[model samples]
Target chain A: MTSRDVLFAAVGLITAAAAVLAVTNRRVLHAGLWLVVSLGGLAGCYLVLGAELVALVQLLVYVGAVVVLVLFALMLTRSGGGEVDTSPAHRWLAAGVGAGMTVLLGGALVAAYGWDTREVAGPGNEHIGEEIFGTWVWPFELLSLLLLAALVTAVAVATTGHSRDRAA
Target chain B: MDLPLAVEIILKAVVVLAAFLTLPLAIGQTEHKVMAHMQGRLGPMEAGPHGIAQLVADGIKFVQKEDVTPASADRWVFKLAPAVALIPYLVALAAIPWSAAWVAADVPASLLLVLAVTSVGVFGTLMAGWGSGNKYSLVGGMRAGAQLVSYELPMVLAAASVAMAAGSLSLTGIAQAWSWWWLIWQLPGALVFLVAAVAELQRVPFDSPLADSEVVFGPYTEYTGLRFAFFLLAEYAGIVVMSLLFTVLFLGGWSGPWSDTLGPLWTLLKAALVAILILWLRIAWPRVREDQLQRLAWLVLLPLALVQLALTGVGVVVWG
Candidate 1:
């Protein structure tokens, strides 16, 4: 096998393992930390595949901001230290569902792609920019609007409570 | 004559790593003497000639001290936190163009890589805070995470403005495409970026996260000896990286006279000046209250960043 293939396999394996660990960690804070590792390993996979832009964006948004925010909220709520208590029945159910989903997805992928290695399309900033602005512009802008609405609603919610407290 | 790819890569890594290790000490020395002079006192006269080896002494002292871990702390995370805090700045440094051709790694989107890795550095502080199992550390980490989240917006926007102007995301490309007039045009965004950078670095005036007065050194309260030194090193390294980045983004990087031969020197000189300015800021302003800090970032810097972005778009459309 080629070096690139081996590298990709290694990164993919690490990402998968980290993903599993993230889900299985008993402490919520440690789970969050594992999620960071999982996301970071996924970025490494993207980098191995030469999708530098996507990889960096993933690291930036997911591992950097999202996980940090998750950890922050956990710490703020003082829940970072405690181990999550899960019933044995619920744990078994979660494992079964997770395993089933994995099998289903793996079977579907194997059926579709078979053994062929598809050629990667352009992977850099230029092409990604075109794809987003050119083809996906509408959905992208719509998403922005949705986010803007969410942002405004959040501000209103946050401020209105503070103002009520001040008046009280 | 071309060198082997592996050798070239190794050499570049060595140089970057050297800078990563040494630049922080230099900056730390600058902070010592400059802050001392600024405060009308001798900073480190006893270490070596003019106290130049003060950081060296500090380094030795730190190395010799007992590395203590709090009994209640998470062992693995506590041990790992300092490295996490320190590595991102080193990675970011590899992407910054010391001159048009001097960057260690010319990643296509180096700016994005730099910003991404630096953002990841916040996890280090958060880890230290939580892992320390100290109330002060947790509170400090919370403030740091919140402040970083708040300031990250304007910082990214301001950097995005630079990228939009240059029409390239590469740090080298940005430097090459830079012209004199951008200094005037990008001033507001530059200010926002500078402010955001200070907050990100947990420096003076924007240092509520590490406010020793209230939080007892914040996430670092539980840290001792070498671990504390590592965190301190990370902060100094952060200052150098951010200052160098600011020089590249806003100033005409290596663009003045004799640029061809003196390009890297010009970049380093400008970056040093910026570092001095950052140090000077320590004495210039008091620590901003956390509320005021958030208000400045969200209400002032964010709007200014948005407006600057719009202006940049207009400028590009009009001038292109």
Candidate 2:
């Protein structure tokens, strides 16, 4: 294997390990922290696989925003010795879902690429912009519209709640 | 130019590490003396010739002091938080273009890299807050998280305008495209970026996280010695990176008289000027309340940044 393949494998391994740790960690906050490591390692894997823009965006959106937001919520919750649910049924269901996803994704990848080594170009911002705005414009705009809807709903809910408080 | 890849990487890393170590201390010293003079007071004048070595003295002290972890704190996370906070700025500094050829790593989309890495640095504060097991730290962390998430919108929008106007996502490319006209053209966006950056750094007028009277040093309440110093160093390094990034984004980095020969010097001078301006801002402004800071981001900076973005889109279309 080439050095790039080795590096990618190493990063992918770390990402998988971190993902497992994230799910299995007993402490909720520690689980979120492990999620950060998993996401970061996934970004590293993306970088090694020659997807620079995707890797950076993963770092930005997932590791930076998502995990931090989750951490923020967990921090503010003021948990007084709250235990994370570790029931056997929940664990079994999570395992089944995880296994099913793994099989589905692995099957899809095998069906599409089938271990065939095909060289792909490293993604630059310009290329990604063109692809998104050109070929995937509808999808991109649709996603933003959804985001806008959520934002408006959030503001409306917050404001109405404040007004109710004032009225009372 | 033809050196082996490993050797070149090592050299570049060493240079980046050297700058990463010194420049923040340099900026810290400047802030001390500059803030002192700005307030008509002598600030640490005895360290070495107008307190030039005050940072050095502080460094010695920090190195000698004990690294304390509270009994109730999460050991690993607490210990690791400072490094988490400091390293991202170092990585961002690496992506920053000192001059045309003076950068450590001119990644394909360096602006994104810088933005991504700096955003991740927020985890440092969050982890410290959580790991400390202090109520004040938790509150401070929540405030910081809210402020960061809110300000990030305007900051990214402002940056997106520059990227659009320059037609490149690379920091160096932006610098190369920068001209005197952009000083006027990008003024609104620049203001948004400056405000957002100051908020991001948690300095005066936006330092609710470290509101000592309210939170007793906030997330840093329990940290002592080297870890605390690391947090302070991280803040100073943040100033250095943010100022340099600002220079690259708006101030026509390395573009000055005789810049062909003195390009790196010009970049440094411009960045230093911006850093000093940031220091002046801390002195000139009073601390803002948390809600006010949020309102400023949403009501003022966000709308301003959106207008700047639309204007930039029109300008890019017309000018291109």
Evaluated with lDDT, which candidate comes out highest? 1
| Candidate 1 lDDT tens digits, B1-320 | 68999999999999999999999999999998999998999889998899999889999999999999999998899989999999999999999988877889988999999999999999999999999999999999999999999999999999999999999999889889899999988999999999999999999999988998999999999988999999999999999999999999999678889999999999999999999999999999999999999999989999999999999999999997
Best by DockQ: 1
Q: Give the interface RMSD values of the models in order.
A: 0.5, 0.6
TM-score of chain A of 1: 0.88
User: In terms of TM-score, how similar is model 2 to the real structure?
Assistant: 0.97
DockQ score for candidate 1: 0.92
Q: What is the C-alpha RMSD of each candidate to the true structure, in Å?
A: 1.5, 1.4
B1-320, model 2: which lDDT tens digit per residue?
49999999999999999999999999999899899989999899888887789999998998999888988888898899999999999999999998898888988799999999999999999888888978898788889988998998899999999999998989999999999999999999999999999999998979999999999888888998899999999999999999998999999899999988899999899999999999999999989998899999999999999999999999999988
Interface RMSD for candidate 2 relative to the native interface: 0.6
* Segments in model 2 whose C-alpha atoms lie over 4 Å from true places: none
Clashes of each: 0, 0
Fraction of native contacts, model 2: 0.92
**TM-scores, in order shown?**
0.97, 0.97
